[model samples]
Target: MGSIFGTDGIRGIYGDDKVNEDMAFRLGKAFVQFLKRSSDHPEVIVGRDTRISGERLQKEMARGIIVGGGRAFISPIITTPGLSYLVHANRADGGVMITASHNPPQYNGFKFFNSGGEKLSRSEETVLENLLSDTDPDRGLKIREEAVYLKEATESYVRFLLSTIPKDMDFRGIFIILDCANGATSSVASELFSRLNIVHGLINCAGDGENINRGCGALYPDSLKEYVLHLKAVAGFSFDGDGDRVVAVDERGDVIDGDQILIIASRLLKERGILKNNLVVSTIMSNMGLMDALRDMGLRHIECDVGDRNVYETMKAHGAVLGGEESGHIIFREHHVTGDGLLTSLQILFAMKYFNLPLSKMSKWMVPFPRVMLNVGVKKRPEINSVAAIRKVIEDAKKDLLNKGRVLVRYSGTEPVCRVMVEGKDRKRIDAWANKIADVIRLNLN
Candidate 1:
């Protein structure tokens, strides 16, 4: 039940024994030591978001890295995308990002990257856990002292961003607003819009470590929805705490999820004749309309478990060009291996420019069906994956939802609960189906 790594990486509420400096130091030492044993003088990069404990963890981690005979470069409070950029641009041996993503302020985690700037492979993680649990610092590792060269990553990151996108993006006629989520995308999005000559406004642009995602991020799109209407902006976008996911506010202030974003991006890619194998990877959480969009264009879909990494792995397995979560961690296989919210925003903007269409019009390609989702809390979750009782409920729900709707029930990966979802053309049916499944799971799985 206890592992250092969680859904993302090493995560726990701050000031807790599980995610303290000692564990941070051990994790750092384990990585550097493992790298040294595998090669000589492995250089790496470490970056963090604007969390209060970020600085202390950075120092302790870096010391462990240097002590284990590796060079560690420090990047001050940049978005998660920025760290990925540094890993590729600087060609570091590895990278570590300190973030808990959309988790509360009191929680923090460390995400490890391999030499390729992607998440650590399962094998690598297993090795690191072994080393962390058993290794002693004083006698087993070599030591050194190195300076942390603080990097202004956004400047270079933005330029790299600009080059990947088209030259003449004229959103002048479109008034767009952006919600920075009081996290990492605060500065970059504003500057990107101005340089593109795209007329836009912004909110929650400054992040106090304590203020991040405090009622103002992708998870809280209502804030941006209100802003979109207040400013009468053409559209608005929201970035998560680490700026890896984007949620948008339409002209009508309707919140747009990644399914719609995927539909738009996939259509654009298909138009450009760059979509690989005419395929996309999405989770079961994707809207039903997305399937219709794919069907209309004769494109296929590969469904994976609900996670960006799972989607990425599916993309790699099927040789698909694109994949992402409902949240906004869209990945374009051609550009980068992992999710980049900045990249996703640019892709959407580029699509709008190419089509010379409004965000609302672009969204028309896929008509989203109503979806109902709820989390059922219980004392403890039992094995419901293949239980006959849960299977019967699923079978009955599937039969009832045939041809017009669907049902999905799974334990929450990040929380102590189970998720029930029902999607269909009818809201009442969706709600009833969702609640019925929830009731069954609560009675048995719970």
Candidate 2:
């Protein structure tokens, strides 16, 4: 009965109170009704990752779509971005991707994208939520239309990704390591790398439905880092469960986060006169050092809230070509609408080829300041500014750091926790300050 959509979409533990077959069916019917506003019999593309629950959830959703007089096209086991690309390419009315993204396999969710390959807006999501609440479960006439399987959906997406780079481009000498997170990209990343003619080694690609994001992928890339170092490859790329986010490692086994990736790509784009307005967009979670690096390069930076949707909106507003979060959701407006991990890996390769430098050396352009982040479990999320004690502590920390660093305290949109982050030149000072703020928040909220 609560709101279904979160910052990303409707996500929760599979079989939990939040997400189940009944909820998915309702969502499918609501989505079809929403689309009926523009079209008589809308066609929707439904896809899912490698989760064990994905098959049942998607089947239930397709059933609701059919009962609501809409056609459902299923692409079994596809990435989130792949679904987006298919929606745009196939000119479908809309699309639904069943995934939990970087979450564990036990959790599953749904992401809806419009025909233009963009995520549903806040208002659109609200309309669907309202429909779900009001619609009767057994009121609609259950039509018996079998969902059509889109056998070529994955192949089409692969072709699109290959066309992004130059046809003559060859990665023969580039030995790279890829960690597919044993999720959606498990079936696609290896093929793409192979077709590109790269000497690549893959890890964590053997998914058993329950193994997705199990101490692998972007959330846990220590093993990939070590492997990259051991093999002395050019670089290593790690993708999340749904292949919309990525984290990279340099040849030296040093991790390159989204901030560094943004800096590297933006610099290259600027030199080629492809960076629109010479500007970039990032979230508040990004390191302060990125701003300093941008200033040095004579580029402008804009900060938004902590979400890829927010970053994309700001990018569109300012005509920025590149934007991303520290969590590795990098969006290149010149390419796809949503984030694509495989495409991001290609861009990194393009940068390396153009610059003719190793990722470790190119990443040196930005020196990240020491950052400390702490999460405090909370019973409820009250406004941080309304708490006198929390506000005073934040103000004091900001004053102490002054121009040397920054402090940010915000509540998580998905979890019941308050995140406190402090960044400065001194590691010890920032760590202490971060814990101090966290303690104050816990005392007040928890």
Candidate 3:
């Protein structure tokens, strides 16, 4: 009964009260109703990741769309970005992607996109939320007819990806590992890499509908590090369940986070004169090292809030072409409206090709300061500034760190947890401070 939409989307364990088939149907109908204001007969593109609940939910949503006097086209298995592309390419009214991104397999959700392939803005989401609440579940019987499936969606997406990279650019000698996380990118990645003639191996590519993000992918890039070393590959890329984010592993089995990826891509784009405004936008969660590296390269840097949507909005305001989060959501504004993992991977590879350097070398520009992050489960989410004890501890830690480091205390938008991040020149000091803050939060909130 709480607000269904989170920072990303509506997410919870499948079959739960909120994420059940009934909610899916209602959401579909609500979305169509919202779209009808612009178009009399609205059309929607629907896609899902490889979760067991996806097909059932898709059918329910299709039924709702039909009953709502709209047309539905289903791209049964596709990445979030792929669905975004198809929405714009086909000129649909809107689109819906059924996924939970990097959340565990049991979690599933809906991500809405407008006609321009951008995630629904906060104001648009609010409209949809109002519609969702007003939808009547018993307004119509379920329609047995399912949404029309787009069989060519995957192929078209691959071709579009190829168009992003130069046709003459050679990828023959680059051996890389791809961890699909057994999600939406499993078969799509195989086909794309094969077409490009890139020598690559895949891990966690076989999804039984239950293994997506199960001990693999961006959430666990270290899981792919050994495979990179064993294959003697130049680098490895691990994508989240829905393929909107990615984390890279270098040849030395070191994890190259989004900060490092942004640094590498920004430098290449700047040299090519494609970096508009010579600016980069990252989230507050980004390492200080990334900001320092940008300064050293004489590139303007800005910090936004924690979400990728916030980063993109900030990028738009500043006319910056590159923006991302430390959690691996990198948006190359020149290529697409939202984050695309495959496109980002290609950008990284393009950077490698442009510099004639290996990822291990390119990733060395930023030396992250010693940092510690602790997540504390909470029974309630109270304002951090409102809690006197918690506020006092955070203020005390800030004073102690002084000019050397900083402390950030915030709640996870998608989960019921408080995250405490402390960074400083001294690791031990930061670690102790982080623990102190986390313990205080737990005492007050739990």
Candidate 4:
């Protein structure tokens, strides 16, 4: 058997070699067995996105859970963080979320959370994978024919979301736009907004399975930006397919990404004297502007690798309450165990109201340096240090930038490409340097 978990979880194209029903079944069984090692009668809360393959995967996993002598409760069509919340809220042994998270419709996967609503650590995943190797698929384990569905799971999650905001707060004059990415949030975003009496407009809330993330959501916020401008709303938010990520557009139609969001939120939290240790955690992908802004506010930040799990671990170690990725996975440790798009959106709104400032004005506190990024397709991902030519190019670029900027070159964890990022005071100079690095990578690796 090979490793099943990725930086997030097990993900692949549906019906593909790694993500078929059989694999899902085996994983389900393995997960339950691993849980049973500690608890005799384990229970799991299962949820999924709006992908067409989600239902089938959920069924197979649930079947395995039941066969392994564990109870499986299905929470249909919920966000990833919603599932995480349910696991901790209900004290289930674990939780499984079926989603590919901003991927195309053809792709689907699983993200597992512990009873604490936190993602499984690397060692935990290793233990589960080891169990998968010992399980016998043909052992004639009796599979349950029916699944127990949780009807009030969505409502419970919504109440939790509302509880995070103060009751006296209102959104009567605040008009905002939302692009649901035609995925899991579509089923709940409107209800949550209505319950809060928020004046909001929505787009891309209709999901046809295949239409989810098709030029919408966080990956493509241009349409959402246009809609925000048209409505002249105070702000706009676009959530990814699984509702784990978000990208925003300000009143001035300028995009505010996760880094900016982190800065803004950090400032607010610091004002309230709740920013733990006065530290914020961000990934390597975060912009230098965020660091500058944090410094200007007399706050500090630490850099982790490019995953929320990594960010969470670092945040925990350092007693930081806030952390996020540039791609919009913002984790507020005080309120959520995982990155939540809905929660992040609400927090941004609360910040806007508390500061009594438009997003455009708040966003101006951080002026991002000019940066150029190029994704070079590669036949294989080689260790950067081992490739002498690539190393030389990277070092040369760093030397040229000196103290004025930075250069980051890393292989994409999920794709066959090398990302070369150059940030500097001059856009043209950085673009040239970035292309120079990309050319070296393509020439040597591709």
TM-score per candidate: 0.93, 0.97, 0.98, 0.97
lDDT of each: 0.81, 0.90, 0.91, 0.90
lDDT for each residue of candidate 3 in 4-122, tens digit (9 for 90 to 100)? 78888788899887687998889989999999989998899999999999888887877788788889999969999999999999999999999989999999999998888888888
Q: Which stretches of candidate 2 lie over 4 Å from their true place?
A: 139-141
- Give the C-alpha lDDT of model 3: 0.91
Q: In model 3, what lDDT does residue 238 have?
A: 98
- Winner on lDDT between 1 and 4 is 4
Residue 32's lDDT in candidate 3: 94
Question: What shift in Å separates residue 438 of candidate 4 from its native position after superposition?
Answer: 1.2
Candidate 4 per-residue lDDT over residues 187-277, each given as its tens digit: 8898898888888998999998888899999999999999998888989999999998898999989999998999889988999889989
Clashing pairs in 4: none
| Candidate 3 or 1, higher TM-score | 3
lDDT of 2 by residue, 1-446 (tens): 44778889988899987679888888889899999999899999999999999999999889888887899999968899999999999999999999999988899999998888889988899988888777657635656779999999889999999988878876778999999999999888888888988889999998888999999999999999999999999899999999999999999999999999999988988988999999999999999889999999999999999878888889999999899988899998888887888998999998899889999998999999999988899997778999999999999999999999999999877667899999999889899999999999889896
Model 3 / residue 245 / CA error / Å: 0.6
When sorted by lDDT, best at the front, the candidate numbers are 3, 2, 4, 1
Better of 1 and 3 by lDDT: 3
* lDDT for 273 (candidate 2): 92
